[model samples]
Target: MIKFSGRGLLLDIEGTTASVAFVYDVMFPFVRRELDAYLQAAWKTPALEPVLRYIAQDAGADTFAAWTQDDATEQAKQQRVSAEITRLMDNDIKATGLKQLQGLIWKSGFDSGELVAAVFDDVPPALVRWNEAGKDVRIYSSGSVAAQKMFFGHTNHGDLLASFRGHYDTTTGPKKEAASYRVIASDYGCDASEILFLSDIVAELDAAREAGMQTGLCYRVGNAPVENGNGHPGIESFDQVSIG
Candidate 1:
């Protein structure tokens, strides 16, 4: 059994604490449909110019300023930009534009009643138990912090956002980067050994392991396996996680 010497818990959302289908079928499609409008509105916002410029740079736009132009060539460039942005999203890269775009698109879905973030039946109870036991429960997802909040804020199980002690996104760092877990362990003010990271993705587990944290595979039926060779623990559910 995988064990932790610390008091903090780092949990993943999709395919771990929550269902994979909720992210893949509902959230991803919702964002894909609303991407165009979201980009347009976000592009027009003066406050978001820096973020847009970052996206342009990430997407290989020749010049950041040129990316904001309204000419047909710029429009074509943005189309290519959008495609590349989608690709990064699919790979769960830590792109700021992708995060903002997801937040906007998810706003549409949340407002229209098209979807609700769903967690497993045991999640809420487990979260409550963990908290009552004085363990900090934090969320780490590729999705933006805003999207993460919206999900728990409007979950099928009701507003579970209150249960989370902290929220992290790609803004912290790419999920597969060992540095991100180090950042999180530091943020939690605990030794990496005291923090237990739960996720369905093996690569993320590997990264967390490299960062010196205890790791667990969520073991959802449809999700990928977390290889333990890199220092992650394997478990099927919160039920399998024993903290004494």
Candidate 2:
């Protein structure tokens, strides 16, 4: 067990609170299957414009219009964006634009009861325990903030969104960077040492530790094996963590 006398808790989603398989097998496939239909439907809508601009910038273009300069028709531009999204997913690239688009797609699935987040059984009770103990709990994930909200709001164990104080995503900064953890600390309005960050990735934990936050390496089922925890405490479940 690990003991933390911290003001807040920062958590990672995939491979930490939820299984990696569920993301790769269920959520990602859902996005791939629905990508074309969703993109066509959302094109030209207010919500999709910013996301397309981001994707354009990610592709090294100044704007979506510039990116699709060769595409004379709306369908052509949409097809280009679709192709780019597919390429990104094929490589498992975690570009901000791709994540944002995936979140939008996921929102539809979640709202239509086609998708339900699969958090571990220990998660809900632990969230309640941490909240009751007066520790502020938040999430720092690569997924978009909107996706995180939808995910926690529609979990198999019921809505866990109320347990969180805030959410952070790639927009905050790369998870492997110490500066990101520092930014999170500032957002939490507390010293870096007053927050405990947990994740299944040792590099992320190392970054948090570098930022002076306590760190724990989670060992959840279906998570990629971590040969070296880099001296961080290992937690198989939230039950193993005692917050003061």
Candidate 3:
């Protein structure tokens, strides 16, 4: 068991609190299946406008309108966005725009009961324990903040959103960068040493440790094997972590 005495907890979703397979096998396929239809229906709406702009910017253009200046029709512009989305997905690129768009699409699925987040059994109770103990808990993930909210709000264990105090995504900064953890600590209103960052990736743990946060390497069943933990303590369940 890994015992950590900290005032805050920053968690990673995939392969940590939730299975990586649930993301790659379920959530991702859901996005691909609903992509074109969602874009077609949401085109030019207020909701999609900023997302498209971000996508355009990610593609090295200033705006969606500027990117598709030669497309000559709404359909063509949408098709361009769809194609770019497909390319990003195919390459497993974690672009901000792609994550935002996926979050939007996931909203419908989650609201309609078509999708449910798969968190580990130990997670829900641990969240409650930490919250009750006055440990500020938050999430840092590649998934957008909106997506993270929706995910925790609709997990199979049910409405775990109340446990989290804040959310961070790539918009804050890359997960593997020490600067991002420093920013999270500042935003979370705690000294970096007061937070415990838990993730399945050693690189992320290394980054958080570099930023002065305590770190734990999660060892979930479906997570990729970590040949070297690089000195981070390993825990197979949240129960092992005792936040004071």
| TM-score for each candidate, following the candidate numbering | 0.86, 0.98, 0.97
* Candidate ranking (TM-score, best to worst): 2, 3, 1
Give the alpha-carbon lDDT of every model.
Answer: 0.79, 0.95, 0.94
Query: Candidate 3 has which clashing residue pairs, if any?
Result: none
lDDT tens per residue, model 3, 1-244: 7676778999999999999999999899999999999999998799999999889999999987889999988888888988999999999898999999999999999999999999999999999899889889999999999999999999999999989999999999998999999999999887999999999999999999999999999999989989999999999999999765
Q: Give residue 207's lDDT in candidate 2 (0 to 100).
A: 96
- The positional error of residue 148 in candidate 1, measured at the CA in angstroms, is 0.7
**Candidate closest to the true structure, highest TM-score:** 2
On residues 11-106, what C-alpha lDDT tens digit does candidate 2 reach at each position?
999998998999999999999999999988998999999999989999999999999999999999989999999999999988999999999999
Better of 2 and 3 by TM-score: 2
lDDT of 3 at 155: 94
lDDT of 1: 0.79
State the displacement of the C-alpha of residue 42, model 1, in Å, after optimal TM-score superposition.
4.5
TM-score for candidate 1, residues paired by index: 0.86
Kindly state the number of residue pairs that clash in model 1.
2
